[model samples]
Target: EDQVTQSPEALRLQEGESSSLNCSYTVSGLRGLFWYRQDPGKGPEFLFTLYSAGEEKEKERLKATLTKKESFLHITAPKPEDSATYLCAGREKGGGNKLTFGTGTQLKVEL
Candidate 1:
């Protein structure tokens, strides 16, 4: 069973609009939490990997943070280029490199 869950299955935003995406997980002994951006017809691009509660990573207008139970992807002043499906995954401790992924949240940014 999948241990990761993403909310709002879909999202729409106007250019320069900011929003946050949610990713809740139920993995036992989580080793790491990952965030990715997937464009149409392309594989997911890794954004961040948070390993502990309170950890955060940022690139450009995107920021990712992790907590004990969930992680969040915050988009600040997002542009249309940021439109894509956001995905989250968790690696189980001692479960090798296998990861459980959430279905992803589709995001659309309009002008």
Candidate 2:
């Protein structure tokens, strides 16, 4: 079975603080690693796609990296608007576009 797990269900950071969250997975074959940011009552907004070991993508204040078994999302100098649930999903071979997602790491950035 394909699965994804994220650590530290929630995090609180002050303005300008930076941190990284982890996502681990177990699957037959990894096709892609996806990162998304979701705010309250909103759907996830795509942030990145990391396809292979050592692959990485970055945008704004976030960076995402992938490996054979896991992926990481690093936040740099975040602001209050950066607060949201960060989700990590993976596509496994034969899974099609049906992504298996982690529970997500809820981030709170206080000014």
Candidate 3:
């Protein structure tokens, strides 16, 4: 079974504060690591796709990195608009596009 777990179910950040959230995963075989940002009552917005260990991607105020067994989403100098639920999903070998997602880490940035 492919499983994903995220730490700090919720996070509170002040404006300009930076931090990194962890996503731990277990899978039969890794196909891809996906990072998504979801707002309240909305679908997730794709952030990055990591296919192998040591892979990384960045955008705006976020950077995502993948390793053999885990991934990290680093938020830099976040603003109130950066607040959202960060979700991690893994596509296992032969699993197709069906992603197994973590519960997610909800982030709240206060000005």
**What is the C-alpha lDDT profile of model 1 across 1-111, one tens digit per residue?**
549999889999999999999999999888899999999999999999999999999999999999999999999999999999999999987746889999999999999
**Which stretches of candidate 2 lie above 4 Å from their native place?**
none
Give the runs in model 1 whose Cα sits over 4 Å from its true position.
none
Best by lDDT: 1
Residue 89 C-alpha lDDT in model 1: 97
Ordered from best to worst TM-score, the candidate numbers read 1, 3, 2
For residues 40-88, what per-residue lDDT tens digits would candidate 2 score against the true structure?
9999998898998998888889989887889999999999999999999
Q: Report clashes for each candidate as comma-separated counts.
A: 0, 0, 0
RMSD of each: 1.0, 1.0, 0.9
Q: What is the TM-score of each candidate against the true structure?
A: 0.96, 0.95, 0.96
Better of 2 and 3 by lDDT: 3
Per-residue lDDT of model 3, residues 1-111, tens digit only = 679999989999999999999999997787899999999999999999999899889999999999999999999999999999999998877734678899999999999
Candidate 3 error regions (>4 Å): none
